[model samples]
Target chain A: MTENNYIYAPSEHPADKFRCKVPMKGTRQLFVIDGGVQGTAAPLSIKFDEGNCSDEILQVIGVRTSSGPKELSSESSFSFGQNSQGRLILCSHTFAEDPFITKEKIKISLAPNSSVDIVLMQNEHNDAEHISEFEIDIQRDASLRMVFLTLHGGKISNNIKVNLNGENASCDLNGLYIVDGKQQVRNLVSMNHKDPHCYSSQLFKGILDDASVASFSGLIHVWPDAQKTQAYQENHNLLLTKEAKVYSEPQLEIYADDVKCSHGATNGRLDENELFYLRSRGIPKKEAQLLQQQAFAYAVLDKISSEELKERMVSLTEQRLRGEFSKCKNCCKNCC
Target chain B: MLNIKDLHASIGEKEILKGINLQVKPGEIHAIMGPNGSGKSTLSSVLAGRDTYTVTSGEIEFEGKNILELSPEERSIAGIFLGFQYPIEIPGVTNVNFMRTAVNEHRKAKGLEPLNAAAFLKIMREKMEVVEMNPSFSSRGVNVGFSGGEKKRNEIFQMAMLEPKLAILDETDSGLDVDALRIVATGVNKLKRPDNATIVITHYQRLLDYIVPDIVHILYNGQIIKTAGKELALEVEKRGYDWLING
Candidate 1:
């Protein structure tokens, strides 16, 4: 099967290539399937047809090691049967000194009475460009929880579409992006409720600094027959500099008379009164600012159900805010 | 051990606290009573080095060091504290973490080792009891969703934790119920020491009845027009500020 072609031995690759140091407990690490394939496209598929699947987490790491400016494409599909429960983590990293471009298309499906949690972490060097598109579907009595964390990248775009095709389905989507140094990030999300008694929520937050730019556009659609549908969406952004910019738009469309929907978007700066209060308590200006930024990010990080993973992500986020990961520590050439 | 001489301050074009002189010594409590818009809050803000008010011409010396050039945090590290009229609410920052960070900063300035988690928690628990605060408040956000009395008690709790040499309470009696006022005053009195001083600024004499200041000053029209003993507070309470302002 094509799945076997994408599975490799973890021992063949070194662990230092990945920027995050958090160890995923009880997780099966999937190595880079197309390690040496330069400027080529790879297609992979994984299926879970068995019922009552185990709680083991599947972790996939996509790494690009070639030192030339090349383009790569990847397409993946994941499906789960009825009554199955699972978790998936997708991470992308680039160790090359030159600029690398990547395009990814992923699709996920959940059958009746199934549940799943997915986490996508994008942490690449400054010379990397990434674009990811996700299409997800849920059947009757199914549920999904997803989080996207963008720590560092030059130009990143994420487009997500979710459809509730059966009754009693629910989904929670969340994202956090911290960008600086001429970086750009864009996120577009569309949630569709087609049946009765379905629910959805979306919350995304971003912090931009040093001439960076970010944009968020989210849409929630409820069909005519989708009675008792409950949906909510919100986007908040904090700009740290005059040059930093953000554009946010939240839209909602409801054809059903018995549905509830709400959307809100805001752009603001750090509270000056709060900063003065903290400073009056003897905390330095820089340290107080870092604390505020960390507090701003905790809302999204608190959604992770795994305690160990949450702690690790918290530390990683703190390091990123402190500008520790902005420099290329592993690359032989000091490009950054 | 605090001194202010010829202090003149302003916000934008309007001037406040014009040419004021005051002296406070160790082991003493001084009360500054003034009407609204008489610069009571502005004086407190200036003492704590808030950037909103510009010190046009003044000199503030604490323990023989000029403090007007210092930042808020620098002044705080130098043992100066100002209890705000309205405590700010900071979401997502637990009281325990905030106190720990502030206490550690103060300790670091003194070349002392930081307290361990257990030691810090023990100290926090002991100080929290001074305000009769419940243990749950330690893990909640700083002043988030707290009642007016609870916010005042939290200010006192912070004062007890920092142990500053010079404490300035700006209108600590406003919006406080009788019970909360007693608790907060008691907490402040408990933290008093022979080597420190306090400046309690209030509009009414109800708080003075509990704290019992040693000296009282009447501030009017951006100046301290009269200075007297504790009996002056009773006089002002009996008669309105009109008698003192006119004479």
Candidate 2:
């Protein structure tokens, strides 16, 4: 519940328009920060460089509204204590309403043998617009696992960059998005392997319907010194309607021949055999589709460790897939 | 229980089953034996309503109703089952869950009450013994990590659970060992009743030795050329399909 623990540091991203003259402070491990404004909100930046503890954990949860045209910006950098752990759980929800925008950046520094996990969710109003930029750093013997989910939004775009600066550094980035209508989502990612023996894997998937559009551009770069590095990247998109569109590109550049790296991208319709199999098993066509889709999303969702959060996301995901969430604001009107 | 007349089927303009006719009354076990590429699997697929094949011209009747217009699930609800030659391996859905869902759907279609958890588990246990399936396999994903024999047994286990009025085993013996074949054949034999019918499609008579089909038909080039008693199977075993296709 603490909302004033972070400060506005010198950031390379476009600075927020409103810079507070007085500094605000609170506890480090637990805090709340809100950003993104459309109808009415003062531009602000977030920074957290204090709270030097060995086991600092940050859990992020999000909520949203669209009363008027407003914009929100958030920026923060984290450096974990040695042999400690950190977690970021991002959840943002918005009902159907007017438009809002967001500019966000996050950085994490893991000490040797330390690990971090980040779970992010962005579900916005259909009329809302959002854009985000992120930068992350992982140090020696440190690992990072990130799960980013975008369920609903209008004209959403994300730019992300990660730097593995130490040996034995590992990173896993997984994402899932379900979009429909005129909505559009785009993601661009850059992963850097700076030292030897680093490992990175990125898996992203999306389901688009009703003329919606999605794009993914991700690259994994292995430097010369990053020999013995192993990197894998993949992007898969399912177009539920003929009018829906998707563009995916997964790239890998290895300067060191000793490293193993691979990339793949596929955009197509659902598997006909799988659908028929379920249908023949006595499930109606629509129910069979939902089952298959949930299974498809499971490839990425299973990576999450929190049961409560996973359950919530799964419920929301089913509603979105059923075309029941975006239309209802207060309660599920489709059931009625 | 099932009747097919002038059944002509094709895949992408290539005809497979051309002007074939067959009939199977309740309580009878009919075996259709044929060599490779003789439309054996296609017949099963067509019966199962697989979209890969087009029934250019045919009439399929099941239980006094026209089944050609029925969707796959509708046909399943009407009590028609096809034990696939190569069973599909679904990685996430479990065997128990799959069977429960199927059984409930059939019940729902027939205006019967859905079985409660306890009742369903009891029936599952009883049916598992028919196929000699280990109880531990109920939780594993459908056909995932199962050996060839285990998969065949699972198919039969599913059949036992559903208790379809008409069951067609499509080459269910292709990749099975002697013991596995015996178990599967025994399961099928024990499930037979005067109210239900079975169609065993195989390339070899080895299976017929166990199930002992009441009627054996030699299918060649998309049509049933000969129909006889169980002795027909023994004759085909001595002389391969070449005699049937050539004569």
TM-score of each: 0.92, 0.88
The Cα error of candidate 2 at residue A120, in Å, is 1.5
| lDDT by residue for model 1 (A175-262), tens | 9999999999999999999999999999999999999999999989999999999999989998999999999988888889898889
Range of the 10 consecutive residues with the lowest summed lDDT in candidate 1 chain B: B89-98
lDDT of 2 at A283: 70
lDDT tens digits by residue: candidate 2, B1-247 = 8999999999998999998899999999999998888898899889988888999998999887888888888888788888988887776667877788788888988899999989999999999999899999998878889999999999999999988889999999999999999999999999999999999999999999898899998888899999999999999899887887888
lDDT of 2: 0.78
When candidate 2 is compared with the true two-chain complex, its DockQ is 0.48
- Per-prediction tally of clashes: 0, 12
Candidate 2 regions with alpha-carbon error over 4 angstroms: A1-59, A67-69, A326-336, B113-122
| DockQ for every prediction shown | 0.75, 0.48
**Compared with the real two-chain complex, what DockQ does model 1 have?**
0.75
Docking class of 1: medium
